[model samples]
Target: MTDDEAGAAPDVPQEPVTEPVTGAGAGPAEPAGPAPLGLVRTPTGHPGVDAHLERLADADHLAADGHVEVYEDVHRGLREALTALDAQPVPAPYENRS
Candidate 1:
């Protein structure tokens, strides 16, 4: 070895290390797509209410814009369920005659 190079560290080949690119030109860090949260929906016992709750799962696979439709449908269904409860005939003890 040459006297000037004698004390220098030996050169070793290295594999290139890569890292995820970020910032303005890096684009999105993850896909800008809908992903499921894997949430579980418990049964509400009431079929109408349960059905509406189940309908919410559809939004998990839909883009943000599509969620509004699912949300509105669930809302409308739940509202109908509530209204149906009000439409039911009252028990004998609760009925009033003038």
Candidate 2:
């Protein structure tokens, strides 16, 4: 091998490096916060059910570990609403006198 070719470095391909643009006229920087899941919650006709479902949104801003509390609260509320339905007193049938 020639002296020049022996001493030269190998020509390996490299990935291009990118840098964020800064200073005048750059678009607004992205927020350095957790992004919401953007899930849409449809409203249920029942207020109690709707409220419980809305409470689930609280988990969006929280870390994974914190989601349990929000989920548990929603679950408890929904369970209470269901239990309330069963606890309601049913009206007795009226007796008819001949």
Candidate 3:
């Protein structure tokens, strides 16, 4: 809450999400090569999402120097926030009738 950082955006984290482990070539790290994403940038039909997607698109260009890690670091807070906010409440166990 410093005077200079009053409205500064939260820093993202540097943790890669666990990728699916199907049979082969599936894990946390992306296989070394160009990503499958084809630089596709389209309107997400949502107001807030497009900016995020565009930022990701911009990030793709800088992935050579472990930019993905940088992204993970940067969006860590956002990811945690989303995960927490999206968590659903569990229901109580039903009791047997006497």
Candidate 4:
């Protein structure tokens, strides 16, 4: 069995080495665009809607220094929209349903 190892021609099939691709539109390495799933409740602007549109355009819901401070501007616009939606990047809660 020495005739060039019996006319060898073995390793002849591969086609399966993928692992060099990348995220589509790989732009913005991650500027933020996730979070805000369920129960988000209002906050990113217009939540209190400018103190209910200035108390219905001056209908006066007791705002003449009567201590109607709109809960500190709706708690600082809901803590800056929950700190910018908790700094985005969230996705991991899908399990097998029974």
Which candidate order results from sorting by TM-score in descending order?
1, 2, 3, 4
Clashing residue pairs for model 1: none
Q: In candidate 4, which residue pairs clash? A: none
Model-by-model lDDT, in order? 0.87, 0.87, 0.63, 0.53
For model 3, the run of ten residues with the poorest summed lDDT:
46-55
Residue ranges of candidate 3 with Cα displaced over 4 Å? 1-38, 73-98
lDDT of 3 by residue, 53-77 (tens): 5566555556477667646754774
Stretches off by above 4 angstroms in model 1 are 1-30, 94-98
Q: Which stretches of candidate 2 lie over 4 Å from their true place?
A: 1-33
Q: Kindly give the number of clashing pairs for every candidate.
A: 0, 0, 9, 0
The C-alpha TM-scores of every prediction are 0.63, 0.61, 0.32, 0.23
Predicted candidate 4 versus true structure: per-residue lDDT over 1-98, tens digit per residue: 87669997777898986555457844345444333223423433654544443433332334445434655555666677668778998999999999
lDDT of 2 by residue, 1-98 (tens): 97668887666798886566666646566556655899999998999999999998889888777999999999999999999999999999999989
Cα distance off (Å), candidate 2, residue 14: 23
For model 2, name the residue pairs that clash.
none
Candidate with maximal TM-score = 1
lDDT of 1 by residue, 7-76 (tens): 8656778888766678766644765789898999999799879989999999999999999999999999
Alpha-carbon shift of residue 91 in model 3 (angstroms):
21
**Model 4: per-residue Cα lDDT at residue 15:** 95
